[model samples]
Target: MKVVSSRDFNQDVSHAKRAARIEPIFITDRGRPTHVLMSIENFRHLTGQTETIVDLLAMPEPRDIDLDGSRPTTWDRQAKFG
Candidate 1:
């Protein structure tokens, strides 16, 4: 992990970005940590947003769904609308 002051970060944004590719970069303001800079891959991993098609396919199939195929009666429609 790398810690950079806000002033230093603003001065050399590219360096911070490069460091973030390997690990998180902490940006500080007034000598306190304020923000983190990290690669998009890391961000997605931490947020659990890195699902692939294989992951989707690996989920267990749903079961026992019931469907009603009957058409609604005219009286049922009228009662619903009123």
Candidate 2:
């Protein structure tokens, strides 16, 4: 883990970004930890959420989806139940 003050990070964003690729870079404000900088891949790996709805839809022939080919049956309004 690498720690960088907000001022330093702001002054040298390229270096901080480069360091982030290797590991998380903790950004501090007023000598206190405030944020983290990390690669997108690492963030995705940590969050365990990489796929989007568009990606799922783009998949070939998903098995779980049920497609209703017929029109929905109309409800009978005359029938009443308490």
Candidate 3:
């Protein structure tokens, strides 16, 4: 892992980004580590994160949903006569 001060990172952001592709880069502020820079693939792999619900919903519907009156679901109900 490469360590760089915030000033250095700010001065050469491009270089830091390039180095991050190879390994994580630690960014420091006032001599203490503040953040990390890493490739998106690496980050995802480390976190094991998956696509969110919004992402799934945004995708085109793969099949048509049947909402015909032929099938009644549990929600269907009737009022009993007094």
Q: Using alpha carbons, what is the TM-score of model 2?
A: 0.61
Question: On residues 1-82, what C-alpha lDDT tens digit does candidate 2 reach at each position?
Answer: 8999999999999999999999999999999999999997899899997978987798799586647846446655565442
Clashing pairs in 3: none
Query: How well is each residue in 4-76 modelled by candidate 3, as lDDT tens digits?
Result: 9999999999999999999999999999999999997798789997777986899899686766766555554
Clashing pairs in 1: none
lDDT of candidate 1 over 1-82, digit per residue (tens) = 7899999999999999999999999999999999999997999899989878987899887885435656553457557887
The candidate that achieves the highest TM-score relative to the unseen native structure: 2
lDDT (C-alpha) at residue 41 in model 1: 90
Residue 32 displacement (Å), model 1: 0.3
Give stretches of model 3 more than 4 Å off.
50-82
Candidate 2 deviates by what RMSD? 12.5
Question: What lDDT would each prediction earn against the true structure?
Answer: 0.89, 0.89, 0.89
| TM-score, one value per model | 0.60, 0.61, 0.60
Report the poorest 10 consecutive residues by lDDT, candidate 3.
Answer: 73-82
For residue 21, model 3's alpha carbon misses the true position, in angstroms, by 0.4
